[model samples]
Target: MSYPAAPRRSAVANAIYGLLNPIPFGFFVAAMIFDIIYAKTGTILWVKAAAWLITLGLLLAIIPRLVNLAQVWITSRRFSTGADHVDFWLNFVAIVAAILNAFVHSRDAYAMMPAGMWLSVLTVLLIAIGHVIIAVRYSTDRGYNHV
Candidate 1:
C-alpha cells in the first residue's frame, strides 16, 4: 500500500515565514543608509566598508536558496513533495529584493550623493511587510508551534 503524502503547512507556518521576510529588507535599507552616509562623509572609509559587508552577509545567506531554486530549474524536477511553490516564489522575490538593494547601495555610494531617503524608506517598508508575511507562512509550514 502507498503511503499518503505529508500535510501542507498549517496557518502558523505561513505566519512565521511572513514575519521573517522583513529581516533581509531591514538589512537592505541599512545598507542603503550606510552608502548614503559614506558618500556624504568619505573620511570614514571603514564605516562605509562595514555597512557594505553587512549587506553582503545578508545576500550570501539567501544565495543558497537561490542556487537551490536554480538547480531545481536545471534538473527539471519537483523541488518538494508538498505545495512548496509559495516557498520558491518568496525565495525568488527575496533574491530580487536583494539585487535591488545592491544596485541602490552601489549607485548611491559610488556617486557620493544622497539617495532619495523617502524612496528608501518606502522600499524598506514594503520589504518589511513582505518579510512578515513570508515569516508567518514558512514558520507554519515548518510545523513551528505558534501556540
Candidate 2:
C-alpha cells in the first residue's frame, strides 16, 4: 500500500504562519513576566503593562488563530495533523484566559493581583503546550486526521 505525499502549505500560508505565530507568544510571555514582576514588586506599572500586553497579545492572535482554524477545522482532511485539534483547543483556552486576564487587569492594581497573574500563568502554559504539540505532531508522513 502507498500513502499520499504530504500536503505542502502554500508559501503564503507558511509565511503567514511563521511571521504571525511568534508574535502573540512573545506578547503573552512578556505579559507573564510582567505579572511576575508585579507580584514581586507590588508596582502598578507592572500590572498595567501586563494588561496592555494581554490585550495586544489577544489582538495579535486573531490572524494566526484564523489560519489555524482554516487548517484544523476547514481543511482537516487535507492538511491538519491529528494533534491540531489539541493545539486549537489549547490556544482557544489560552485566548479565553487572556481575555479574562484583561478584564481582571481592568480593576485597581492590587485588586487585580494574584488572579490576573494566575490567569497569565494559565494562558502561557496552554500556549506553551500548544506550541509543543505543533512541533511534535507535524511532519510529512504523519499526515492528517479528522475531528
Best by TM-score: 2
Worst 10 residues of 2 by lDDT: 137-146
Q: List runs of model 2 lying over 4 Å from the truth.
A: 1-4, 139-147
TM-score of each model, paired residue for residue: 0.41, 0.88
Model 1 ranges off by over 4 Å: 1-29, 33-47, 67-91, 107-127, 138-147
Give every collision pair in model 2. none
Candidate 1 lDDT over residue span 1-147, tens digit each: 455665443355346544554456556567556555655667456345634754664655464454445433544345342334454555566555555544555553445334333334444554555456656766876665747
User: How many clashes does each candidate structure show, in the order listed?
Assistant: 30, 0
**Residue range 1-147, candidate 2, lDDT tens digits:** 687777776678668977998899999999999989999999889889888999999999999899878877875446776678898899999999999999999999999888988999999999999888777766434655557
RMSD (Å) per prediction: 7.9, 4.8
Candidate 1 local Cα displacement, residue 4, angstroms: 11
